[model samples]
Target chain A: MNADEDAWERGSGVRVVPPVQPRKLAKVPFVEMADGRLQGVVSSGSDIARVYVSSITAGTHGFNCSTNNNRPCGGLGGSSPCKHLRSLVDEAVLQYGRERVARYLQIEVGEDDHLMEGLEGTRESAPAAVVFSRFLRHLAYLELPVTTEPVAEMHWFPATRAVI
Target chain B: MLGVQLAQLHDGDRPGVAEALDLVAGFDDALVHGFARLGEERAAALTALAGAVAASPLGPAVSEAADKVAAGSIGEEHLTALAGARTALLGAVHDALLDRLDTALGRTRAAWEESASTAAPADNLLSGSRSWLHELGITGWRGVDHDLVSSSGQTLEALLAEPRLRRLAVLLDGLAAELRASCPIATMARLPVRRWADLWTRAVLLSQPGARPAASVEPVTGRLLVLGADVHEHGTAVQVQVHGVLEPAGGAPTRLVRASVAAAKVDTIVGPAVWRLLAGHPVLLTALAERRSLDLADMPLSSSGDLAWQDDKATVGAPADPFATARLQLANANAPAVPPLERHPIRISEPVLLEDYETDGDRWTLDGHSIRVDLDRLPASGPLTPELVAASSACIGLVRWDAGGWRVQPLAVQATVKRKPVEAHTGDWAQGPTDPKVVKAEAKAGDAVAVLRERAGRLLRE
Candidate 1:
């Protein structure tokens, strides 16, 4: 949400989207399917200063949630993932896409299979260090000056071809 | 080399200018003996112009001609007239070249400057087309060469004044003028900037002799009334060029559209055999046989007129009448003057229709009326072309003004088979399924065409 600093400078709280979809395509600012886990950082809806580092482990379907300083999230002591992890999967579906996320998690998904519904796991405490660091790097990319030069990470993307 | 001499006319270096002048004079040096032998005093006119005649606009030209003649080169009769006259002729051509360049370059500069001043970003989707030229590999131009051939607004400031484009612009402008001069259709202006650049790019890549195997691509949009299709093998690649009336989308008038594709691009199509490619694309035979108008969306169109069989959706409809199309769409239609760069024999440079044309000895005549038929320029479609000429009295032929008159080369014949009227293209060009088994094969085809079609979708990705 801090990426909205430009909008704040422009005197708007955030870039406005027309009243269409109830949620943004990127509800969780960063998400990726990596290291046998569906992982990302989710901004805490209640606290402006906080974010939850979340992950759903592959095969075993184990899950974990924690803050930046390794404070275990209270919502981890439950059968279901907290709202932050749920929102992370929702945005992951919009980002890496549903089929990709399902496959990476080793789920033999059915048509209409909810990504989170296919996973059943117990409380798991995994270090949130790597995902939080990746989230910080993503924010750094957003701060880059607008340029025509190709972005190294986006070489395979179609829209980036022109900038090259 | 003449281009270099023209630029040197203003050079202060005497030896360089003199050498260039000698070359220019030498270009017509052979004409000296020929014209003098014919007893025309004009041959030696340039010889006596006085080497000091440096005050004339083509002063350096006069001084050079005189020096070449005076320095034991005969300050006299025959060589003088022709070289001197040739110098003047070159002067006039040089001036005309500047005029054409000024107009074209000025328009490009103005358009780009206007776009530069804009605040809000304007949607430039239909602003112009993009192309992929296959050289060592596919090299693309956003539009034009990004200089003289650049699309409006793509470049800024004096960037459009780059020398490469300006130099080629002269040659291309000359080519465009010659093509228009021979074209029978009333003169419209030259090709639009983007199309002109497309022609220029093709000219640079595939214009060489025996270079048919090389390929370049452009996209085809809108609907086209299919007239005919043919495939040719050029050692390295099999080429297909389609001729038809293109009704461009966004409500543009119907005009003749030529699109091509090379078989070499199809990595799976093993060799450059017509049958090998055609077997995979039986639809080419289907369209050539029956009148089929196709509406294409984002297809890889290459060369002069071949839209290579690719996975692009080509929705075909019936009632494909080439004759009726010529009448309504081509008759009185402004024939586009494109740079005749493609090696493909049937460039469809000037498409027109005729009825009850008169022929005597070798001359053919038409009313120059409307309601045109498929008229191919080369008439290289085998024996059937001449037969359509000798046997069928009424047929559409591509006409060009050459040797001081029009030449009608027939491509399609208007006749009656059984009780019904039939429009038949001269030769059997497309090779695929024939008889009732392959009648509607154009709408669908083998995997080769499907692969070619699907590649267009992923072309930009990889």
Candidate 2:
């Protein structure tokens, strides 16, 4: 290397801490349903995807992505909450209290009493306490060591192909 | 009884007059003391008695004796003469006292008449009540007599009660109270009456209804940053733009306000020197930047029509004459065609240093361009001084184009100090050291130029 490049390489070893992120989340277009659920579409360039925020249990929030093969989204695998779900819950708690959220959900479900009755036996078969215990067990697995080595050999590529 | 005894004595009756004379003789010492104390009034009384007795049957002897005493020639020192003059002198003393009382009464009547015309009833009541107090000979009327004090107090109270005069009275009272509080009572009493009257008059005038209070005008202050100056139509007019910060009294300074002055009004506003300096923009901008603040106190807000003739006069002088040699071309020689003279007025506005000056000729050099100044057009009696020439050397001159190159007939000069900062040499790779040979050549040229300038100056002086 040249003398200037050598000096720069020696200087670059000093640790650089990244700047702290702002508490305020970026604004996104969203709709509030009668059932106290939030639905929105977040687009990155040409890729548009629908996302939904719903409570798993009372006072517990979760989100799902329709475009992600009907999987739980926002880095949340159907258990622990993600940033999007947390942001939506924060916005809803700020706009409407917990009591109002509960009232709205009750009113939304009351309109379809017959459908709720059909699912009543299935809901009774799975107790809320057991589901909560299973969610906690999944969250504990995230902290356990899964491997001791690199998961895969990483490869680098040029961002764009150029004519030579 | 004395008058009856005198009458009897005058009719030559002996016993009754002799008894009265004996009684007067008994009071001789008292009479002498009374006459001595009375002085001039006693003399006047004796003189009147002498005149009255002259018409009486008392005869000329009695009147002559009284006249001598009245003239102060005879006194009790000559008891025989005094006794002979006694009847007239004693009568005069008694009559003088009565006359004094009558004169006092007359003066009182005259005083009443004067006061009746000039003083209101309130003033008379105050004066009349104070007359007795004045008789007591009190030095001041503040608290000695209650009637006089109350009367004066009532008068002041009534004056203060007047609607029209209330403000004036209050102002005066406040001033008086302040004076009384600050000074001794003797000093307040001794204050000059005329000064107090003047103060009162001014206060009244100032406090008059509809008299607008004097407006406090704060002087305008600013920093004038001259941006550019354009000398239009030669040297007749100039247009100048200046960026300034105006600091009004009791207000924040407003920045970057542009003020432009026209050339025709320049002479009357800031005079010709500033105008010439402004017209030569680079020097002015440099000086303004160096000085930071411009003193615009000499600049005027309105034009006075003084420099209106400069533009017209610039176009009016004698026409240029071609050299005689230009006319003499040899036959068969290929000569250049004579071009028509351009009549368009050419103006040069630049700062120049007058290196050489003389009555015969003068030279001004600006940015390597040297021009001859026509000095014959200057007023003959007023010769330019060395200091004036040196000062004018650094000034801007207006030159016009003519057949004989550029000529400056009327050069406007302003007195100003040129500030040049010392520049340090910063080493840069692109620049190289100057050649010593070129520097030597430039120095030789400068010396030659200086010698030529001195020779030209000497010639001009001659």
Candidate 3:
């Protein structure tokens, strides 16, 4: 076999997650892997001021899509995720990398598999205001002056327990 | 032969099959007079043995060997070869016989082909390969004889020109070599041949005469829910070292199953980094790219963590979340302290999935302790390492101790890119869309965080 082909086959078992399927990133401005789910902010496609907080966990694939004020997405009725939540995942993959998104979602990806395709769950509700607020807080951090000294606004420390 | 015997098994020929295998198995009675009297009785005994295992993959070779031995002039090794053929006919279900048979494969002349390989293909390679397999008298269990494994060495050597077959030869020899090596079989990169009969069914002689053995695995048992696996190239052979959790039947606590599976090629058609795993592995290679726990009732494992699984014993389970499963399974499991003098160890005992950790510069704060992240251990073949490490993120990683201190090889990561939380697994990290700002930020001579820190230092100087 050709060396290039050999290179292609050699140690190539681990796959590179293809770039997340092309989707409109602008529709979903903020995304993050947190709280054992993909939680993010997704702007309403029709309404200018409307934005929704969307989340879907890995194992349960339990999903939620609601406005910052807690109004539920009308598209949330059926078994499948509403478009807003789908948009949120698309952008999350873009920002975090597909494997990270899948890992956060707790799913293993297949070649040509849409990140959201493997998920199946009922539409559960969560506070959009909190997710939207986190997005705002995330934006707030970017505006702060960068310095080695910890800023008061960013003064958060993880609670620790000793490992024996 | 398996199809016939399996059908026979379905037909309730259990006792008959076992008896057929045992007939030749008791050859010491037939060979009382030794080589001088290796006349009709000896020839008939060898011939009967060949007939008894006619369903074996190596049956033709056994029959051929019997004929050659019957021609009146033969040594004691010929009788040993015939016995080996009979033993090969008996499946892995026979523990003692297969052990001796697998041990002898290393001494076979064809065993040397494992270390030597050529990129060249034989003339009429496909046809040649088909002929070579046919010449070996492979018919699954019907007639394939493992005892005669060395008899085909010369023929196999001639076909080493075929790269794929050559790879198979190397794999066979590799398995045999593992059996031969002084090191414990558990630590070997390859699985020990579980059954002498499997050699006949594996590779080109399977199902049909010349079809490749990609799936259609005959397994023993036990399955692992893959947490994560890295496909690494150590030398010539490739390895997919997997870390997974197995919840034993009957509500037992899930134990970690670390399998360093070997493979011949990346099965691109299946999923990302999914290996067309080396033949005879219990779990399906597709499991590497799946969230489902692999299906196998018996997974070949040693106390030291070496294992091989079969597809036959497999049944897919509910989807698994590697990080979550590891976190839950390894919770009370004490992280093994790095033994003194261990340096850059590839793996650690009692792997713990440290969750919700923050990465700052070279240090990662998890639970409470801040451990220095060792970048050097991050293999270069893994393209996602730098970004996964560079981005200040909430990380999930397998914690290990390096020469410096505790380090983590991130399995998945969630980072704020352009003020948004993004997630990734090492294998599929590139599948997500790239943030222009992150890319631009990385490209700039000085990164935003570094530039800011530098200005603060300049101000101190001023």
Best by TM-score: 1
lDDT of 3 at B47: 82
lDDT of 2 by residue, B383-416 (tens): 2222343345332222232221334433223333
Q: What tens digits encode model 1's per-residue C-alpha lDDT throughout A1-164?
A: 35334222222011111111112322354565555567887767787457688999878889999986689887766687887888888876654456656765776657877777777787687769977764554332212221111111110000000000
| Chain A TM-scores, candidates in order | 0.70, 0.30, 0.69
For B1-462, candidate 1 gives per-residue lDDT tens digits of 012222332223323333333443332332222221222232243343333234555466556654454343432222333234434443333333333322321211111011111122221221121111111011112111212222222221111123222222222322232222222212322212122222333333321222222234456677777654333321112334456776767876555555443232211222111334434444544555566677778765443233544533566656577777766665433233222222111122344455565544454434422222222232222223333444455554443221112234455666544545545563244543343433343223333333333333332132
Comparing only chain B with the true structure, the TM-scores of all models are 0.42, 0.17, 0.39
Per-residue lDDT value at B444 in model 3: 38
Query: Which CAPRI category fits model 3?
Result: incorrect
lDDT against the true structure, per candidate, is 0.40, 0.27, 0.44
- 2 or 3, greater by DockQ: 3
Task: Give the DockQ (2 decimals) of all models.
Answer: 0.01, 0.00, 0.01
- Against the true structure, what is every candidate's RMSD? 24.9, 48.2, 26.6
Better of 1 and 2 by TM-score: 1
Please give each candidate's TM-score. Answer: 0.34, 0.14, 0.32
TM-score of 3: 0.32
The lDDT leader among the candidates is: 3
Q: Candidate 3, residues B136-249: lDDT per residue as tens digits?
A: 332212222333333444444443333345434433433222222212222423221212222322323311223321211122344466666543331113444566666555
